[model samples]
Target: MSATRICALSELEQDTALRVEVEGVPMAVVLDGNGEVHAIGDTCTHGEVSLAEGFVDGDTLECWAHGSAFSLTTGHPLNLPAYEPVPVYVVTIEGDDVLVDPAVTRPTN
Candidate 1:
């Protein structure tokens, strides 16, 4: 539940997605277009699909199955078929390591 070390910060490339599990929580860690790290629920809200396997365009990750675009910071679905928002975790970088806290997430709206 606390901030757990997920991986090395160098392991993530800019604008790429990395699937990680912390405290049994499946998450997708992304280095966005601006080279900022973000953590969000890996599963798509609309279907049984992995968001890590989806497309990363800027800060939006589109579910490959239903094309549901979820905001990286807010985790809100930007389009249809997925009215619910995914969970966005808190990512902290310590030196060269990436830490994520699954217990902490952005407020859903």
Candidate 2:
């Protein structure tokens, strides 16, 4: 599927995460302090909690339940309890809109 408009760019706050679901796929949309947008799976791999309800430190989103920090770029957990990685979606900004395709994911290394 092609990218779908999830939210407006103006709706996002720096270093904060917003939970969004597109076509039944849940995601966490984050605007980092550096002014870049990211889309990753919202479910924490360790605690199965919402990552959007967690904390954003730089490019990492830390799960509030277990403290597992996932890399915003790679989707890999950087701490204990969460060894699995989540899916990272491609983000496209058009005008004031933030678009994401739930069917599309970026290859992580």
Candidate 3:
């Protein structure tokens, strides 16, 4: 499947995460302080909680339930409690639109 328009780019605040669901898939969209957009699974692997409701530090999203931080770029958990990494979706930007493809994922390195 192709990328679907999630929201307008202007609607996102820097250093924060926005929860969006596309095709029944839950995702956390983040616009970092560096003006970069990222899409990852909204569910935290450690606590089964919403990562979008957590904290955004630089390129990492911290889980509010257990304090586990996941990389917004690779979706890898950088600390304990969350050994499993979330899925990182491909994000596309067109003018003022922010798009995400639930079927497409970035390879974690």
- Residues 1-109 of candidate 1: C-alpha lDDT, one tens digit per residue: 5899999989998877889999889999999878799999999988968999998999999998899999998999999899889999989999999999889987866
lDDT of 2: 0.97
- Stretches of model 2 off by over 4 angstroms after superposition: none
Ranking by lDDT: 2, 3, 1
Q: What lDDT, from 0 to 1, does candidate 1 have?
A: 0.91
Predicted candidate 1, C-alpha RMSD:
0.9
TM-score (all chains, Cα) for each model? 0.95, 0.98, 0.98
lDDT for each residue of candidate 2 in 78-100, tens digit (9 for 90 to 100): 99899999999999999999999
After superposing candidate 1 on the true structure, give the runs of residues whose Cα lies further than 4 Å from its correct spot: none
Over all chains combined, what TM-score does candidate 3 have? 0.98
In candidate 3, how many Å is residue 71 off? 0.3
Each prediction's RMSD to truth: 0.9, 0.5, 0.5
Pick out the ten consecutive residues of candidate 1 with the lowest summed lDDT: 100-109
Candidate 2 lDDT score at position 76? 96
Candidate 3 lDDT: 0.96
Q: Which ten-residue region of model 2 has the weakest summed lDDT?
A: 100-109
* Tens digit of per-residue lDDT, candidate 3, span 1-109: 8989999999999998999999999999999999999999999998899999999999999999999999999999999999999999999999999999999999988
